[model samples]
Target: MSSRRRLLTASSCLIVLLAVGGTVVAQMEAGDRGILPIDSTGTLEIDGIHVDVGGKDAASARYAGWRIAQREGFKKLWAKQHGRPESEAPNLSDSVLDGLVSSIVVDRENIGPTRYIADLGILFDRARAGELLGMSGEVRRSAPMLLVPVMISGGTATTVEIKNPWQRAWAQFRTSQSPVDYVRISGMGVDPLLVNAAQTGRPGRGWWRNIIDLYGAADILVAEVSVQRLYPGGPAYARFVGRHGPDGEILGGFDLKAKDSADIPRMMAEGVQRMDELFTRALAAGELVRDPTLITVEPPPPVEDELAAIQPVAQVPLSGIQIQILTRDDAGLNNAVAQLRTIPGMEGVGVRGGDKGWSILFVNFRGNNVTLASAIRARGWTVSDVNGTLRVVPALQIPGAPSGQ
Candidate 1:
């Protein structure tokens, strides 16, 4: 099941109090999204550790190599949690995770009489590993966020629609020790295709909220990674810059230098790690706050459920209600029109008029003004009935830079 669906199940009877009203609200984080999850429920994979063994026989040599791998695996986990790392690791004479090592695969190997050399992958029991790391097993994680991985390569920019290697890299990004909770929304359909590189720089609460709603996320994070290579075969350099909504952007970017194409994975991993650090610091400093406007209400309850009885049936009959909507761009305009048609009483949407900065939409809705307004709100939009006339804002994610430092 999706994380959002799981969240709804747990919060079935709970209420989301209005938080944007200046009250000190704590972000209720769920699921695991840390660089090194303090308390992992899934398998803990440790890779790239080298082992060398010299024994009296090939059988003894293999046994010795396996022992070294188990010890080394625990050491890597320790160093990850403690960034400084220790030269001498504590002896694991009686670790609970001793017999819990699920699997060990050789990455690269060379063998000779009475000797063995290999790089290894060790899988440890996640729960036990957390205990060994001395973690409380309760690290607060960030909200589920939609990541728009923008790739600038070969003198051109590639978004989700373009199908580039950079996008694939992000798709395959493993959050082994990362703090960022990335919600990998697919780039299918027209909406994703419409998003371009220029959109990342722009922002509007309405547009962002709409986009966030579409992907069932609470926020948006833009990871702009530009990759470069000197010639036919040279080291590749990846520069990562990140910004998030609603309004905390890191000013500078860090560069990841890779040995070659084979190192792209490492570069991407490093980039995510560094980006996670910036966000973690920001979150701790109280600079990163969740947007209350983006928090969606619970989905409609099932017909067979008792909770459905409490739902209001504020249906309004056809009344030929006409309204005017102002949109920032054609994209928003189309999005607004599509959403408007989803309303029960909304009959049709016609273009009354339009221009560069704004457009006029005639909403042929059948419902009462109040019902129509509530429908818009449920869709993460704000509508107004002014002097018996309606001014509607469509629920769509548009792009623009807000007055954020």
Candidate 2:
């Protein structure tokens, strides 16, 4: 073979190899490796066996157990890392940590007459919970009866006894105390009025001091008070007090100002809501608990700019062709220009001057015009024969710009 011919063949082979390599690299770069988009409305299965309490489905009985478990795990991990005694971990009662796991839902699926399995799904955050609840009427209409777990707590027990003889009789006469309710300490020899006064803070510290002195044998004191009025020097006052032991230590006391009665309930409710919010925040910050199943869905892969993939190739006919690209502004025009620069034989790809939006691509076509037009069309762009020139416009560009403008 002639040396000149051999050089030409070698150059052609190199070009082919480069083009093939570039295509493979681009394909690899564009590969997506993220979570597949699952339908928001999908079934969740929780291990039901974990929730058994007193012949009741554990989901209904232990409401925030998963959340508590997560929190406990976090505390345990923190204690290990900080070299703190695990026993010193924050003492969050089951009730206190219940709010963190309220979004967990459980379902029972029957495998046999006496056997079943529980499926669980927990909303990772409030937004996810809300979404699961259905963000719109259409979604809500489709999904209903999202069964969620409830958290219940058994409170700490504190024992108290009435040491006074008279108070003991009074206590014996009253009905039984309810669980989790305060028990009235009775049996102290102190006068009921004096007790009331101490409870109600009428006789004040002097009266309470005297009662404490008298109840030296008692272990805990209880006082109940009610207010009659607010402003300065009103007849409103509370006068119930009960002293517990020989030392007269006040174990529990109630304050009742007329103003407080109306606001206390609201304040209590607000406190409960605040606690719920705190738990939610703690869960979100990964401070209280971590659940491996509560994985956040990875975001979708970015869509490729279809127009930018159109490579400019040389040897394409451009006789009398005028290409004008209308972009939003210079930045957009610059982007378009950058993409155009990659096209072979396409030269002078520059942004238009002034605020008039557009980028211009001047191509010196030397390739087959038909083949070039087909490639542009395949990329969803338009090719037009204008004034005997082949004008190419990206589909993403603004419509209605006059040719050659």
Candidate 3:
């Protein structure tokens, strides 16, 4: 073939490859493979409630066990709250108990023709139970903190990049008893692209601030677990570390071992409980304070004298305010755009295309460029106006963020 023909063929192949890549990315975005967190909010969960009962049939036996679990769980909850023995706990009718119990969680169970033996979790309606205990249900909680459960195995660290037992344990944890207000994300949609193992290593508070704000959290909690497999289907050990903030200040750490692969879930559950305890203690010690750099302190009001001296200026809404976001890839472009749309006064935000490593977004604002810049900066993005075009930069040196086209 001629050189010109060869060049044309290669260009066509490149276009086809680009199209296929774009399709894959788009499909990943639309896929629903992420795990949704269990809803155990606003309920006091009493785990390790054991019940063994027998009946004429398997279903009847299971029902009897669940009823007995409600009674036993109530006693445990009373002792937990009042520091009394289970025998001293007051009794209520089965009908009343039914009203207080929210759901039954089967921790472990065995079923036979006429018997049911199980360890269970009982969720109690906090308000209803509190009324019976003659106390308030209110509990002091810390500022909202984003939880990123990182699992390290085979020298590789991952968080929601792939489903693992560690992530599942954290997602299933009941937060009603925890003092830390943990904001958990279902590792779906673009979650893996955003909250990954590499993201925890980023030390920029500015970048974290943006991410935390997206989740309506004030700070971050890094729950890291390193798994050590002794052998195939043998014992396993895991080291867990609870770190705080973008700097990864160590709150606490511990080690756990599982007897075998089947015991891994139980081990992970214990790890999560211990990790929550560490966070709780850290919060009590005032160690879980939000980073000052992450908080956006609004500009103070102008004094009366300064305000009086200022001349009134006509307000003009800005249109076609070009924002160039620097990005590493298409994911960064999507993230930057999502963050920008959250800022107030930005309307009809639309991408205007850009060269490699950057994307241009044109938005109509309800205010001027100065107000727009202030809003963008509040979201932890570095913004500057150059020749009427706004250049927005991410705090972390991540590619595909705000860079001019």
Candidate with top TM-score is 3
The best candidate by lDDT is: 3
User: Where is model 2 poorest over a 10-residue stretch in terms of lDDT?
Assistant: 142-151
lDDT of 2 by residue, 293-330 (tens): 22234679898788876786454445323356556576
Candidate 2: global Cα-lDDT?
0.35
lDDT of 3 by residue, 1-405 (tens): 101011111112242323564553442123353456666665788888778899999999988998898899999988888888999999988888888876777778888999999888887877778788666746789999999999999899988877788887887788877888999877887788888899999888777877888889989999999999989889999999999988999998999999998889889989999999999999999998877899966889867787779999776666668888787689888888888778776677898887877778898887877888999888787889998888878768755443444
Cα-lDDT of candidate 3? 0.81
Candidate 3: Cα lDDT at 53 = 93
- Candidate 1: which stretches are off by over 4 Å? 1-41, 45-48, 54-66, 79-90, 93-98, 103-121, 162-165, 186-199, 246-248, 291-405
Task: Give residue 315's error in model 1 in angstroms.
Answer: 29
How many clashing residue pairs are found in candidate 3? 12
